[model samples]
Target: MLRGLATINFYADDVEAAKDWYAELLGVEPYFEGPGEGGTTAYYEFRIGDHQTELGLIDRRYAPPGLPAAPGGAIGHWHVDDVRGTLDRLLAMGAAPYTPLTEYGSGFVTASVTDPFGNVLGIMYNEHYLEMLGLR
Candidate 1:
């Protein structure tokens, strides 16, 4: 049975840059750095959001074969207060827009972007999510 999200792992060819970029975006440095080949950092993990969800960046060198060279996969959208502003910020940060802001009505809006590291990052304004957390 599926529980809640434990971690979201993104593969990047430059894990160090990924680490720095994510830290800049999330406003917190990774709490864990895993050493990889040649004594370089192969992994970085950050705890974020109200739930302190785990977000991980792994070196692409360790990625299994058959991985897509482009961003195309299931997206997990993180809840945000301002979808439009976040999308704008992500675009300003050099992330290419993958999905334009869309309104699904009833207080549901979504957007997504492909990070410079070729990973899709989604953001959403979900009414249900906020209501469940007593934030609506």
Candidate 2:
């Protein structure tokens, strides 16, 4: 069982540049830097509020094979207190929903959307029953 979304890892061509861009976008600098392998490559992380969910920047050159190229934005779904309200705010800020909300099963709702930069985002919430099942 998990508490919530932990972190999102992104590959970047230039780690420093990507970190700077995300720092500006998120309005928060990295709070922690991982230990590099011989000071060569490492990850940069920023926290989301008080949660463990983080935005991570990783080195593209050192990434495993079969993974997408560097500087490629990754899609991540985030749960909010109010999906409609959050959608409205994001829309006003230039985000667009790719798909309308739909019910997956008992007490589960999901929607697909895209940020201004083209990164896909999913929004979802669990019903009380699902929460009781520890799926939230």
Candidate 3:
């Protein structure tokens, strides 16, 4: 049975750069780093946002076989109060636009940006999410 989101992993050619870039964007440092197969750090993790959802970065060399090098897939969007503002901030931080801000009716809005590491970072302002979190 499926539960809540555990971790969203992003592949990067340089794990350290990805960690530093996400640290600046999220305003927090990675809480965990992997010793990897040979004692080199090949992975890093950060627990972020209200639910402490995990965001991870793994070295591309460790990526599974058949994984595409291009950035495109099912993005897991995080809830935010200001989708546009968050998108703007990410863009200012050198993130490329993946999905422009769009209203989804009934007060729902969503957007996304592609990080320098080629991962899509999704953002959304959802009333349903706030209600579920008891934040409404």
In candidate 2, what are the lDDT values of residues 9-106, reduced to their tens digit?
Answer: 76666777767766764578899887666775478998874355787777766667887432234445566657777667666666667878777787
In candidate 3 the C-alpha lDDT for residue 102 amounts to 94
Comparing 1 and 2 on lDDT, the stronger one: 1
Model 2, residue 101: C-alpha shift (Å): 1.8
Off by over 4 Å in 3: none
Q: What is the lDDT of residue 124 in candidate 3?
A: 96
- Give the candidate order by descending TM-score: 1, 3, 2
Higher-lDDT candidate of 2 and 3 = 3
**Native-referenced Cα lDDT, model 2:** 0.66
Whose TM-score is higher: candidate 1's or candidate 2's?
A: 1
Winner of 2 and 3 under TM-score: 3
The lDDT ranking, best first, is: 1, 3, 2
Q: Write the per-residue lDDT of candidate 3 for residues 1-136, one digit (tens) a residue.
A: 9888999999999888999999998899999989776778999999998889999999999999998888898988999899988998999999999988999898799999899999988999999989988978
Worst 10 residues of 1 by lDDT: 127-136
TM-score per candidate: 0.97, 0.53, 0.95
Cα lDDT for residue 56, candidate 3: 91
